[model samples]
Target: MHLLHDRGRPLPAPVPVPRDAAGARRLAAVYAPPPDRVHVRAMMNTTVDGAVSGADGISGSLRNPDDSFAFGVLRALADVILVGARTVREEDYRRPQGRADLLEPSRRPGGGPRPALAILTRTGLLPRTIEPDWPTYLLVPRASREAVVAAGIVPADQVLAADAPADAVARLAEMGHRAIQAEGGPGALGQLVAAGVVDELCFSLTHRTVGGSSSRVLDGPAHEQDWHLASLIVGERATLTRYTRA
Candidate 1:
């Protein structure tokens, strides 16, 4: 991988992204959140034509080795990962296996080796594949709170009462979570964008295009926000760009 830009400035020479253990540490450092405050970073992979998925109809098909590496790096660096319920189901989301050495021991109130998974859903029903155990939290409205609790999917404390996407984010912050990473489905991403909670967008573009009905990275109504490219890199037959809200 080669970096094309850093801090939004054009780099005269490309920088290589290493593949060894030291390389992994470097990659995590590239994604570390600001130490002073919580940062909400949203990441997604898409086709060249803006479709969020490849011809195979999944985001995985649009990724290459380098993109996969960056994905893991982000998960390893985050304090908690916020993802849509639909995305969790579609992506067959599993408990994050964070690199023990890369995890921040100071970000979250409770120090855990891996980033916890926070699932956003208004419905009380959860995917059968999902196990509501420790390190897993559900974001749902108060209306669905009883049903979710009654279903015995997770502990009552793990079921957060929230009516909107912004509410969910606020609740996460209250729990002492910083460096939040939202691996999204467009709908969920859209809501967060609309809520004005998204601080940065880590977008990866594939080398190919798929002419389909796949949604864009953000699927909400008209809501414009200024963004500036924080960094850009090329590798794995894809372009990885980080855009920060301005």
Candidate 2:
């Protein structure tokens, strides 16, 4: 299928939510995108220099209560959270949670809404610990039908093919998901960036540095041009940077 860029219609300009403590208290509203729009947002915490992980191979180091709350604000506004299976399993995500207005009973606390938890994996390997009762979607390679069936989760209509990353984003838009928030493993976020599918990047720059030979943003296929950056906010100990495809 030919990729649908522009989707033949103009989408409304994104509304900006003011940064405040009260805004953090509010249950972020869900984004309802038009059927044809493919809106993607990536959320990641990086060191002062931009390493997603440390030399110890631990990513949990990149979390703070303030940063976590900021992430909740973004999650409350999202229709769904799209993450790579490696991140999911490695993170050992059990259940998702949400606060007052954002609460969807189906998901765990601080986990945001029942908006589907979408995972991208080529091997289709999923942890048996997670119950099939929750809302989840798996995007896997076309060749992994058997594994998908074994997992007993419904595979999306568009399975990632040889061009898995490209197909994944296209399928996401087709499935009526307007805003996709990519929670990372670096490679997955890079894939979305390379495909030009990402719309906004809500980056949390922490105060520390993990100097190592690890991945930085956009480590996937090389882009001929640089991405556009906007809305630079400098916090007390952290900075929030937003980016869009130029």
Q: Which candidate is the best by lDDT?
A: 1
**Any idea what lDDT model 1 has?**
0.81
In model 1, the Cα lDDT at residue 131 comes to: 74
Error of 2 at 185 (Å): 1.0
lDDT (tens digit, per residue) of candidate 1 on 1-246: 877788879889988876556767766666667866878999998878899887777787887877777777777778798989888887787787556556655333235567888999888556787776647889998898898888877888888988987788888888878778888989989999988999999987877878979888999878989999988888767888999999
lDDT of each: 0.81, 0.61
lDDT of 1 at 135: 77
Stretches off by above 4 angstroms in model 2 are: 1-21, 25-36, 97-100, 103-113, 153-163
Model 2 lDDT per residue over 178-226, tens place: 6567888788888877777777776778778878776886568877645
lDDT of 2: 0.61
Candidate 1 shows a clash count of 0
Q: Residue pairs in steric clash, candidate 1?
A: none
